[model samples]
Target chain A: MDKEFFRETLSYKIITFLKDQIAEKVDLTVYIFKILVKVIKDILNLRVGMKHILNQAARFGVDSLPLALIIVGVSGMIIALQVTSEMVKQGAVDYIGTLISLVIVREIAPIMGSFAIISMVGSSMAAEIATMKVTEQVDAISVSGVDPVTYLITPRVVAGFFIMPSVIVVATFVGLFGGYFPVHNIADIGLSSYLDSVWLGLYEKDIWVELLKAAVFGTLISLVCASIGYKARGGAIDVGVATTNAVVYSFIVIVITDFLISYAFFY
Target chain B: MIKFEHVSKKYDDKVVLNDLSFTVDAGETLAIVGFSGTGKSTALKIISGLVEPDLGSVHLDSRNMSMVFQYSALFDSLNIYENVAFAFHERDDLKNKYTESQIMQIVSEKLRLVGLQNIEDLMPSELSGGMQKRVSFARAIVTNPKIILYDEPTAGLDPVSSTVIEDYIIRLKEELKAASIVVTHQMSTIKRTADRVIMLYEGKIVWQGTPAELLEAKDPYAHQFVYAKREGPMKTTAEAR
Candidate 1:
């Protein structure tokens, strides 16, 4: 009876669940770190194939650009619509562009751009790799005496690391442009006034920080998504699970990393 | 030759292969037969280095080997030509060794060897299952490997397709004179291609003999498997429960 009670108790169940979750998280972190090390080694050794990198670059950056612009543009307009009226009421019209530019550059563009890519490019990468793993395509690559990391992963990671900033740079400009409509219409601010205020608020440090954040987010998304996909087993169901986990984990990591980076830079 | 000495593997608490040992000599084909979940494919994976055994070692006379996967496993992104020529173009050691013209010639020759011709530009998704399997076969031999492994080479195919694949297996064995391990359940594949056969159950070889012996032998495991009988020493999951 005592054994049954201990096993069936809510507290026991909670503890067991927590333990399993922590163990899974730890295992995943170790796997991702190992993959990252391998990817870096392959990149440094120049073992990563150039053609593959260029192909992945087109998929990750070029193909994802239009959607990223739309998402960032919408987000920028939303932020402007919400804040411009209040700032104008407070007679802080001059600071309107500053607020919008800072928020777009530091926060909205990177985070929203990452979300867009995670939805489009990152999920597809995960699903593709997960399918490969399940179908023994990965095994075939391994049997051919080719390093799967160099062949499958390094290219994606390298593309993500290098192409993400370009995506964010494009997204940043689109977002800033998106803010223009609301500020001009709602607050009656002229284009030149808005442009001047945007220029005044911008600093070289902010641009560098934005680029750095975009690069980190890009690497993190690709690495985390691919690592999860590579570890997937089973069939179609497992592939679906892997894709979901990739997107969810990417979102969580991006938010957490964004917070950490913001605190480091601004605080 | 390929040798497995006291190999054992497990996933979590379930023992898939326990103290398994076997050997396949050069120019010979060894068929690994088993019911589902009996570690037939796991044994092949261990040999191909796709999976490591928990306890034991696999010895190979040559590290140059290729595996033809169950589903063909051709890279979907690459065309039939690229799929067959993958090892030559992608492997670091071989990529620079062949010129484009040489690679093209080799790819065409391999595709022809598999009875496939002039379909190089088609994607894997466009190929039939048997054609895909043959292309994978061509890819496997692209490196001129001294060891070749096939995991269910004739699975999910029509009878005619299976026979074609079986014939190619024999032809490849004759041409490469390589050590080959075939994991399969089909009796035709066994009778047609295997020089020796080993039956696995519960992670151990329950029977070992030639194809003729496998058919006539009074071994219960072999008999039940060969006849596909419901009443046998091997129990299904429901029967076990």
Candidate 2:
């Protein structure tokens, strides 16, 4: 009887813990989904709040272009140099463009582009929203009969959605150009030959996949950042925690998304 | 009129407000006074719909309301003009009645009412604590909301600034004819602004009457609170610890 009672009590505790954990995650997911729906609705009704979305898009997409270009450019050059050196040793240098193009487009560009967005834009969104929450600005807005989801989250998500792809496109082109430089200068391959192999290796489907991945990753980053920040409580320390959480969650989501997209498209 | 009936709120295991009820008539200023953590600010938040009571309901005769937060809660990214304008721009129907220049005119006018003008181009961070409070006041009154909630308006202000805010509350009551609920620690503000006062103790109204009655009240808790006495029914944090 004693053993049965102890086992029953232990099982109850374990079940309660698991239930609470699932409930918390479900609650968070539901909140995020609600914000996502509101954002999509605002996009469909673009004429209603066009000004905010345009301003956010300009801020999120245009401002980050320079950084995106530089990071992708450096990343592509490094990969190209390494790939060319390895291929040269194997006397398979002709296939260097195939390796670089596939790796950059299918993997590197979207992931790096998102990393830039997560580090820069995602952290900013989290800090701004968390500060708003801490200072009662979020409550103040809500009291005005304006839903924060519509007024705050929508414009940001829309802006991020448009900007992520633009950054990725910039990253892709910068990366391709970056690969061309190392191959032409160091690998003793002509620009035209590298260009020809890149052109031959590239597929219409791969380009679509890169664009799709960028858009998805952008949405995930913005959604996670805004949600985490909006839910942040307490003081300045909470805002810091929210910002860190936003970046960490965004990276996790982006990597998981990248894997899913690559497997779905490539496999 | 704004009314909270049988309201209760708790944060985890600690109860903030328990079975609280109150009402503020239209065009009347009601002061909520208490020791810190007695849920005075929470009561105002309940009335403003910033927080929903765990039990009971808050009924507002009009949906239009504005709250002046304790920390001012100004949008840090926006300049003074934009912060005040946010109140107007948030309502599409309101925005339809005014052109960009007209909206700017309204924002300028509201700023002037709070004794702030030409500082519209400046950010909230550029302003002093008093100026931020005044800016938030401008934002609150810009729309001329039917109900106004001031949470610790004078809590952190200097004497001169507190006087300014107190005087503005009186002026706004006259001009807008709006119902106001003010939560404060300053005795002078209660005498100056409130038509009636309610003293909260442990989320319950222990004594309630006009400012005059608050002074003469026999309730030990009320006496200790109003006179800022060290000895009475209320225990200091150190003593309690």
Highest-scoring model, TM-score:
1
C-alpha DockQ of every model: 0.85, 0.70
- Candidate 2 per-residue C-alpha lDDT over A142-247 given as tens digits, one digit per residue, 9 for 90 to 100: 8776778778887787777777888898899899889988887777999888888888889999899988998888778888899989989999999999899788
Stretches of candidate 1 off by over 4 Å are: A1-11
Would you give me the overall lDDT of model 2? 0.87
lDDT of 1 by residue, B118-179 (tens): 99999999988999999999999988889999999999999999999999999999999999
Model 2, span B1-241: residue lDDT tens: 8888999999897788999998898999999998877888888877877787899998888887898999999988888998999857877557577788988999999999999989989999999999999999999998888999999899889999999999999999999899999999899899999999998877899889998888788889888997799898776546655
How well does candidate 2 match the true structure, expressed as C-alpha RMSD?
Answer: 3.6
Error of 1 at B161 (Å): 1.0
Task: Give lDDT tens digits, candidate 1, residues A16-82.
Answer: 9999988988899899999999999998899988899999999998768999999999998999999
Clashing pairs in 1: none
RMSD of model 1, in Å?
2.1
Candidate 2 clashing pairs, residues 3+ apart or interchain: none
